[model samples]
Target: MVANLDASSKAGSVLIVGAGIGGMGSAQLLAQMGYKVYLLDSAPGIGGSMHLLDRTFPTDSCGICIMSPDQPSYCPTLECGMHPNIEILSYAEVESLEGEAGDFRALVKHRPRYVDIIGCNNCGLCVEVCPVERPDDHEGRLHEVKAIYRPPTRAVPDTYVIDMDYCTRCGKCVEVCPTEAIDLGMAARRSEIEVGAVILSPGYRAFDARIKGEFGYGYYDNVLTSIEFERMVSLTGSTQAHLVRPSDGAAPRRVAFIQCVGSRD
Candidate 1:
């Protein structure tokens, strides 16, 4: 998945390895400074882990909304996609880095999304016709979605991606797509890009609650992870913001929060 960089292409270019808030913000700032910015992320769409949060701490504001007086409705994630100087490489990861401080070559590997992002209009016809269904990982597997599905509500490059693991390759989505955007035979790609600088903003991974078996994260029906709880309370979550027990639909009369279960070790 590695490729040789073209020497002539190296200039005032920057590569930001992650499409979270920090990465997207950096890309926009650099692009404004007249630099060609490449925003790379290993997800179906941008927005990173921020897509999981219902609200931010301290202020308790919506996580996705970037408030600004000039444009109060501005969304940074969506803006990154529209930036002329910025090229978003979603569903991709940097495999290797070469060269020196001033000029560097990055070998990037892109995973196959199957669905064409540009050709697909987010019509959801592919999703409607697809017979395969899987637990929605974005929603903490609390709900189900078709084999081909969109990343999130406000994901940049808003389009559907096929979960090849769950897909039976029945070709129902390709047949029903009005835009003919689906391709089950799509293959992964690799590219080498020249950049003046590289910024790493790979976000944090939530602690796996299953590691501490005492809490019975997967074994017990009532047990839940912090992320699971966050998704449960989210307005876009399974219950549509209503906090309820996973074991049963009824709202729990009592709740408990354990602090630092896998930390301070």
Candidate 2:
């Protein structure tokens, strides 16, 4: 419903600082209550921490599937990112905020997606031809990911993002995309949005396990992070969710975890 906004309008409006489930839920509620909501996140897609787990606790139900529209019991505002009255800006972050409560102004820095979100159809052709492969940061970088790849299958804003750091400028994905969505070069843009209130749901970042050299998080091939282990056992993850050692891709019979790697009294 909020196709455009005026900073001067002090009407009901909100700026949600993250696009995770919490942020999405808050935005949906505020919007349903007659407020213009804008959701933002640094990641290209939503789902946040839930997207990394193999199986949810207590119930083994698939995390992504359970969050779909059919699973209204889970989240009534499923696909909230694309909901009307709510606009989501992914691969973006709030650089600065000015003005007081109920009438705030913000500067959002949007990193280039390389692929146009409006044009992508999720055909997954770009992933097939893109030769650039690197450790997927989504799974805590446990699995391999193409330079141009989509988030989880059910992720909102079902679009692909390019890891420009490892992209070789080969333009293979660009050539293969059916919708011509891939752009090897895209410029970053900034948005100046105004809202009556702000809601922040920026999630926590995984602690770098490499700091504790004694634990061999990166030194030992067999050692893996908790997130990595979760990905290894994830049905949609690398090795087809097989419980295998990263060292030689062999089945692991038993595993041990060391807690509080960086946290100590």
Candidate 3:
């Protein structure tokens, strides 16, 4: 038996707490059902951990090329950005939540990207002028990038973001930018939003292999994490798909894969 519930009585908005594949998928579905979705993420851009991968398991397919129903050429990440019902709130986190299921209030804290998403045209000029260089986290620190850079190749809101930690406030990028989008003094913002429901999809974090000193993750030059190995062989990675030893440019004669390093514990 179906209960004839009044559709007008319930709120029509949803707050999705993560912007990973799972959260993105959920947001797209909800938005299709005539609900407004607020896709919030702590990173400067969306795609989550999956964004760092070269290929997926079993099928060995590109991890970022998620199929979209509306646009065959666009991935879900890009689709979410273009969708009218979905509002991407990147570089933000949920501070608090209150109220009942149908009528909920959330306090969201947003971190400054230090670059205007809509203003910047992603011309790579800022990256060329900026003097500061930092280890690229996306490549497992195997490569270096300018302080101001895109999170990934195909990141949504596809704009440059400043790594405030490494930024020297040199003002070189500011002078060279054609659109005047670089801002070193930008400040964080906070907001309170009302939503009909809350969905928590905070993804998993990679285990720190350094804790297990026996593996020599940090000490040995040849030692590599699963992510590092994946990046090393990735076609778009630092080596351009060439599998070579980190200590030297030579191809490895033999390799060992240790399964269940953190999981077994």
Q: Highest TM-score: give the candidate number.
A: 3
Scored against the true structure, residue 254 in model 3 reaches a CA lDDT of 98
The candidate scoring highest on lDDT is 3
Give each model a TM-score. Answer: 0.89, 0.86, 0.91
Per-candidate clashes, comma-separated:
0, 2, 0
Q: Quote the lDDT for 21 in model 3.
A: 80
Looking at candidate 3, the ten consecutive residues that score lowest on lDDT are 1-10
Write the residue-wise lDDT of candidate 3 on 1-265 in tens digits. 0023222344678889998888888888888877778999998888887777767777686676643344343677888888898999999999999997778899999999889988999899988888888999888757899999898756677788998899989899999999988788899999999887888999888899999999999899889898888888888788988989888789999999997789865
Sorted on TM-score, best first, the list reads 3, 1, 2
lDDT of 2 by residue, 1-265 (tens): 2334443365468888877667766776676666777888788876677777656766887665455434444542345755688887878889999887666899999999898988989898888888878977766546678888787645667788888899899887878878888877799999898787788888777788888788877888898887778877888777667898777878989888887776652
lDDT of predicted model 3: 0.83
Please give, for residues 116-210, the per-residue lDDT of candidate 1 as tens digits: 88899888888778888899877765679888888987888778899999999999888998998889999999999988778898987877888
Runs in model 3 deviating more than 4 A are 1-10, 66-73
